[model samples]
Each structure stands twice: as structure tokens, then as C-alpha cells.
Target: MTATQDSVSSLQTSVPPALSLGVVALSVADLGRSLDYYRQVIGLEVLEQDTHRVVLGAGGEPLLDLHGQPGAATSVAAHTGLYHLAILLPGRADLGRFAAHLIREQLPVQGASDHHVSEAIYLEDPDGHGIEVYADRSPESWAWQGGQVKMDTRAADIGSIVASAGQDTAWRGVPAGTVMGHVHLKVADLAASRAFYEELLGLDVVADFSAHGALFVSQGGYHHHFGLNVWQSRGGQPAQVGEARLLSASVFLPEAELAALRARLLEAGHPLPATGDTFTVTDPSGNLLRFGRKV
Candidate 1:
């Protein structure tokens, strides 16, 4: 059954309204190359680094963890894995500065879209892992109809966004408050994914784009925290180990909410081995999601 916001509220269990995304982990082919791309192009600062692993973020908060596996195969379109890791800038001005920086860098942007709720710019990392840097419109500006947010793809007003940068046009790095907003994944089946994320994980379906083979879910009344689509990955296989792809995405929840989710998973027959403060689960489509208590 397709889950709607009303139906989600009626569920016996639901993800805490305060739930939020945390750092996303990825496997990259070349540590050095990926680091350069993320730092120079994506504007993330290196927080910690070692030979095979690196942690990066903005404003001292961890946002991404890259694990290097030398000679790893690059991700393929047929693999059911990351579609994009979205970075949420704190404000539209930040996005404007970023947009101007990309222009100055002459980086090739794949696409730019105004989604009504937000404006997004899309690109790829050194390993072809997709990336989206965006700023959301104010919550009050968002439109809701029939328990679903009204969103569409339209050309973004780059000129207006650049103007929003105002006098502080210099591109320093992503400022404080930047975060890993959401993670979009390519899955083999939309229904199975919905069942896993909505039913088992308890995230509410905020939007259903079944006609486009996509679904979006979130906690609270936010537009979406996770986007699942089969646009190119229908009937696809999971990424093989040692391939450059998403390793996992983390979410933070209140302690009680985390415990409730754990119990629900256990009751539903999803194996969740005991972990200290955090636990990881593989969704039906093989996506790894880690849950931890929100501090």
C-alpha cells in the first residue's frame, strides 16, 4: 500500500518528528582525488584523515566519510546505489555564493532546478558519485496539498541566486550550519523500498511520484529526508564490494525513538545486531541505514 501522510500518522509506529540525517559514508576509488574534488569543488573542510579514510564537513560538523579502497571499480548505472548525496546550505545566500564559486571554477554542472520547496544544483564527484548542493525555501513558503508537498522541476534563477550573495560575494567555504540534508538512492523496486522505509523504518511518505517511479519520505512536515527512485535502476543489482558507491547513511533520533524503531525492526524480522550506541540496518533494496541517538 502506498503510504500517505494521513496514513502514516495513523500507523501504530512512526519515526520521531525530530529525526534528522547525519554523516553519509561512501567508498571511493582514489582517496587523494576524491579528497581534492570534495575540498576544492564541494567546499568541505577535512576534519580527520588517515591513509584509507577521511572525514569532511563544514563548520566543524562531520558530514561525509570517505573510505578509500585502492583500485575499486567505479560505480555503474545499473547498480542500485546512491543517486546523490545532498548538502543543505544554511541559506539562499550561501547557495548564491556557491553558485558563483562554481561559475568561477568553471566546473561543469549537470543540472540546476528549482523544486519550489528548494533550489538545487547537481554535479558528480571524482568517482561519479552524484552530489546535490541546495538551499531550501522557507518552510512557510512551501505549498502542501492533500498531504503532499507541491514540487516540480523548473529552471533555477541563477541570476537572482547570485544576486542574493550581495556584497559578500567571495567564496570562502561552506559556512556553519551546512549539513547533510538528504540522501537520494536508486533502488530496484519502488514498492519494496517504500515498504522498507515507510513500514519498517517508520518514515512518513510525504510525496509519491509513482508515475515517475519515485517516492519521498521524511519525519515531521519537512518535504523529504530520503528520496527513492528507480528511474535507471529498476531490476538492478546491488553495488558489489570494492565499488565506488554509497556505503551507508546515518540518521539521528531521540533515545526513546531509536529504541522504539529497534523494537519494530526486531518484530518485523529484520536482523539488527546489537551495537553500542548506534545500529545499522540494510533496507530491502540493500541500502544501509545507520541510526543513533540524537545528542
Candidate 2:
């Protein structure tokens, strides 16, 4: 059974309810190369670009911003950073189109699988950040029991998933309520992970399974916003360069609330990084984090 629990008395939703998360930025070894891979190869439009960063989008808004930081190195087993940035697609058809595109372009896929709850396509961004591009199977269809969300990893009918995307003449972006959704991480200790993301981050727990080596939590009512798994770090300490380095994770808050959080972080000694008008910060595990008004 899940161990994490939602501590919020009630979820405070903002006006219009900010879409899950608009953009997740990552620090990469080669900004130019990654930009080319995402834009030219991945086919995402370039919304904005600068010497230090580049934002790419599927349609209306930017989904990912790639930042070039020379010294940002990551080791595969690093338990201190981002787990994965999930991109919720418009539908199965969109997934189809992307699959076809990957086949046509010779794009490399790390792995693809059906998580019972959702079908996911995964790949690593140039800087070693985990990226999951997926489509949901309608909320009403999701299976759950005993307050535990049932998720499974099984073979995906790629042919069927791809067929959906190939249906429409053009790709419709991610669904209306889609988001960066949940971020999963490898934490040193279950208790400490709970202390920060739940008590401190203030997100409600949706699932907590100490037995399954995972924990899931969310804000408002849209599944989990973050997940923590101790399978890799069941008894390890916070070390450096574990294969994966969570470049940065984002949380969207109202503009005013974001300002408040900035002050809160400073007061807590987790100073936000100032870049032009953006203020970013690093979490206890050295993972970079960004916050801004919900977009």
C-alpha cells in the first residue's frame, strides 16, 4: 500500500486552473546540439531562444526549455535530480504520428511500454534528463482499488497507438488538462523525501507504496505531481554524478504566490537563481528547480 499521504487541508486551485506545468528546463552539455535534436529532429517548434536557453513546443505553448551549462555533469545513478518530464499528448493519434516520425527520422527511443494507466514513450534529452511522451486512456477508464492507483508496465500496441496519431491531418498538442504531470525521483530515505516534497512542498499524497518502492503525490486533483522511489537508494546517501542529473523541475504557482515562494525560499536559505526575470533554485539533492506564475 502507498505510504505518503496528502497533508493539505484542502487544495487551493488558482483561477482558470493553471495547466499542469507548461515548461521544464534542463541543463545540457551542448545547447546547440540538443536544440537541433529537439527542434529539427523532434519537430517541436522553437518558441523562444537565447544564448543560454531554447524553448520548444508541440503547439501553442512551450513544453521544454533547454539550457546550456558547461559544467553540468550527470552520472546515471545520481539520486539528487529530475526523474522524468512527462509530456501528455492530445490522444493516441498524436502518439501514432510521433511514433511514425521517430521511425521515419531514425530517432532513438530508450524504451516504450504501457503502464496500464497510461502508454509512455521515453527518451533521454541530450543532458541525460528522462523524457516521457505519452497519452492517457481517459480518466474514467483508469483502474484503482483500495485507494491505490493501479499502474502496470506491459507491452504497448505501438501499432494502435501510432494509428491514433496518424488519424488527424495535423498533431493536436497535449490534452486540455495535460501537464508535466508527475516527476519521479530516487530519494535517499523515504522519511526525508516525505519531509520535503510533502510537508515542505505542500503537495497532497495520492499514492504511497513503500512495498512497491514508490510514492506518488499531487496538487489539486490531477493524479500525482511528483513520485519518489527508493528502490535505487534504499540505503544510500546523497552522492554525486549518479548517471542521471535532474537538471531542473518546475512548479507553477500564481504570480503573486510565486513571489511569495521566492521570499520563502530565501528565508529558508534556498536562494532562487536570478536570470533576467526568472528566479530558479536547487533542492536538497542538488536538483535544479524553477517556479513561476502558472502559464
Candidate 3:
């Protein structure tokens, strides 16, 4: 709650142990096509695969384990599923290389914008799930005021951003230790999303703008890691099982703090829908947020 040189990082009074992030999975409509796109265009190395799924990694660590199935490809305008899976590049030259790669592979970006704290290239995956290719500006450079995280989006000069992606090399896949930086959501309602992620889940509200139908928050200030947008889904519900399902998600926390949060949420009448070494609560929007000891 206090800020020194590093203000955006939310130092919780009773933080649970640090269970840093784990891998994220996407259930794409066509496993082969999705895998091909990620592996070839995005430059991720495939770890393992069979008839049903494929696991992938960048720098040798798994980032996503994709489940392939035959399902209806819904309209991006109406799908109540993933907002985007953000892939954090090590630097900007890598981002440029990625931009080059996107251009090479004929990958179409929905839009690319610079959010003062970072620059991002946005695209939709094979099954309508959103994807963001981005890299952050240093933490020391992030700005804050009035109990809100400040962010602005403008045209990121494609040439400048690509030049920064990697000073020497092109950003094909993330460097080793790449993680699911953060998961953004396109929920139906902002207030409900805020209540569940902030109030019920106890995440500090880093930023909330009523006009934008958007919010930006993170445990540590890493430039608005998790994003929520409701432009199309003004009041949509979570997607059903047949079309798609969110296999799982996580909240990296210190192991020391799990029991306390679990007890706190239980006392608040929002006990875990499922619990183990970790506790999980489904948001009003049906996305699962996992809290557990930091791995």
C-alpha cells in the first residue's frame, strides 16, 4: 500500500506465500492448426503432443498446453471466452522480430498500441481467443498517482517498437523463464468483475475507469499485467462447456499466505468452489482464479 521507488507493486499486508504463475492452456478448435500457428509463426518450440493435445515452451519451459478438439468457431464479437493470452517478450528487438515474423507469416494483428507503460501487438488466435505480444518498460519508469495506476494507449511506432523488441535478435518466442505474464478478461460487466477480482478475491485495485469499461490490476506493478475489456460482451456470461472451457488459472502467492486467504474468503461466504494445497473461487463471470503457495 506504500510506494517508494517501486509504487505499482502491491505489497500486501497479509500476502499469501509466493506461488508464482504456472502454465495456461487454450482449448483451440483445431489443435493442429493452432499448434502450427503458434509453433511456426510465434516461434514456440513444441514440447510434447499426441492425438488430443500439445504442450509448448519458450526457452525450454512450458508456457501453454493446448487441448485440441472439434468445436464450433464462434464469432469474436460474441464469444464469452478468453480475452487474450499475453506473451511477454524479453525486449523490444525481439518484439520487432516478432512483428517481422507476423508480417512474414501473414499473421494479421487486430491492432497494435502503446500503453505508456508498455507496447503491445494484439491478435486473435484460431478459436477466437485474444492474444497479445508485448514487453514492458522498466518498473522504475512506471508512473502512479491518486490511488490509481495511470495508463495511456497510442500508436506505437511500428518501426521503433520492432527495433526495441530485440537489440540484436528478433523476438520469436519468449526467453527462458517466460510465463503466462497475466490473463486479461472480456467480461459482461465491469462492476461485477471488480467485485469478484478485488473485493471477493482481495486483489488490490490498481486502476478502475468507469468510462472505459476497463480495469488494470496486478500483485506487483509490472505495468497493468491483467486487463479486462467489455466492448463486445457488455453483459455476457461465461462460455459453455461444449464450445470451450477454461481448464484452469492461477494466482501466484507465497505459500505462507494461502491458509489465511482461504480462511478470509470462507469467512466472507465466498469459500472455494474447490480447494487443496490451493483454494479456488469462480468469479461471478465463471473464470477460476487459483491462490496457493508460491512454487
> On a 0 to 100 scale, what is the lDDT of residue 250 in model 2?
68
Instruction: Let me know the TM-score candidate 3 reaches against the reference structure.
Output: 0.87
What are the Cα lDDT values of the candidates? Answer: 0.89, 0.65, 0.69
Go through the candidates in order and give the C-alpha RMSD of each one to the true structure: 3.4, 5.3, 3.0
Top lDDT hit: 1
Clashes of 1: 0
Candidate 3 per-residue C-alpha lDDT over 183-261 given as tens digits, one digit per residue, 9 for 90 to 100: 8877777888777666655565666775877887655444455676787777776776556445556666654567667
The most accurate candidate by TM-score is: 1
Candidate 1 Cα misplacement greater than 4 A, ranges: 1-13
- Per-residue lDDT tens digits for candidate 1, residues 1-295, read 2344454345333777778899999999899999999999989999999999999999999999999988888898888999999999999999999999999889988999999999999999878899999999987777676667778999999999999999887889888999889999999999999989988788877889988999998878788999999998999999989789899999999999899889898898878876566899888778899899999
Order by TM-score, highest first:
1, 3, 2
